[model samples]
Target: MKNRMTLTFDSRSENESLARVTVSGFMAPLDPTMEEMMDVKTVVSEAVTNAIIHGYDSEDGKDIELHCAYENDELVIVISDNGSGIEDVEMAKEPLYTSKPELERSGMGFTIMENFMDHVLVTSSPGNGTRVELRKKMVAKDRVCH
Candidate 1:
């Protein structure tokens, strides 16, 4: 089975959960394991939160895009924003390196995503935009026989 979805919404903190729920609901038919579901949700939350807070710098009226595709036991998720892009992608991915230390951000967004997902890719330029791609392979739960 193959399934895919794309969502676009205003870059707001409140809308972050919407992205997570949408992906979770989309993946329901696959009967993913509980751990897989939580991992997916966690990565979605991190990517969407980064798009709103870091990509757009909490500026209103900006748009964030989330795309999810499931095929052959693999799930691909892409989150993008057309806002101030990262100047240093490598540095940003380092643990505990937040751009907004004043906000008490731990700067672990990329790290968390990398740890949870099988593959992660980040692309950004200074003035263009930022895009985060996350991929995970779902292992089907073993059915118990009575």
Candidate 2:
């Protein structure tokens, strides 16, 4: 059996938690291991942060959309925003590379997403928008303590 869910939220750091909670709820029924939960949470955080910081430039009223599908023994998450897209995605992926150096960003958003998820794909264009998709294998819980 597989499950799917999608959520849209305003582009704000505060709303990142909502995204995590929604994903956590969807995965709860699957009884994911603790490490799986952490991976999901971290990836969601990085994606949401990118949407707010890079996409929207921390501007208020922008929107971010999150879509998740659990199927084929895997969990796939996609985060999208209709804000200023990256001009150079390849450069952004480099370690310690950041356009907003003044903000003290580590510029590791894409890198972290790649590391945390089994697979990550990014699509974007200047003035168009950005979408980050992450996929991870779902490991079913092995023990049930009641």
Candidate 3:
């Protein structure tokens, strides 16, 4: 069985860092490469930021849930929010397509996610909510025994 942990936090901008750090700490035992560590952190940041900004529309009192698990060389993460869900999941994944252009959003959340993780799955429904599931296989590190 994979070791797993779940976090439920308020959808606050400051909490984004908290989410990143939490995952960083959780994955410590894997001895992931520096680049792998950074990639995981970046994806977590993007997912949390999207939930706070787009899903909840930056409203307070909303909860974002993050679940993380790892077994051997693979890591899995899922972030979800119960805010305003996405209407078109396919279009939302397109590059340079953002619903909130007025906010200067780059619309690259999913793009960046896909670039970093081995698998990215997004599920949402208008007024229902959004869930981002990410999976990555950490590069094996040469273990030297003394």
Q: What Cα-based lDDT does every candidate model obtain?
A: 0.91, 0.87, 0.93
- In candidate 2, where is summed lDDT lowest over 10 consecutive residues? 137-146
C-alpha-based local distance difference test score of model 1: 0.91
Candidate 3 TM-score versus the reference:
0.95
CA RMSD, predictions in order: 2.2, 2.2, 1.5
Residue pairs in clash, model 3: none
Give the poorly placed runs of model 2, Cα more than 4 Å off: 140-146
- The alpha-carbon lDDT assigned to residue 9 of candidate 3 equals 98
TM-score of each: 0.95, 0.92, 0.95
Models sorted by TM-score, best on top: 3, 1, 2
Residue-level lDDT of model 2, residues 6-93, one tens digit each, is: 8888887889899999889887766788988998998999899989999999996988999999875688899999999999889888
Residue 66 CA error for candidate 1 (Å)?
Answer: 0.6
* Top-scoring candidate (TM-score): 3
| Candidates ranked, most accurate by lDDT first | 3, 1, 2
Across residues 90-129, which tens digit of lDDT does each residue of candidate 3 receive?
9989999999999899999899999999999999999989
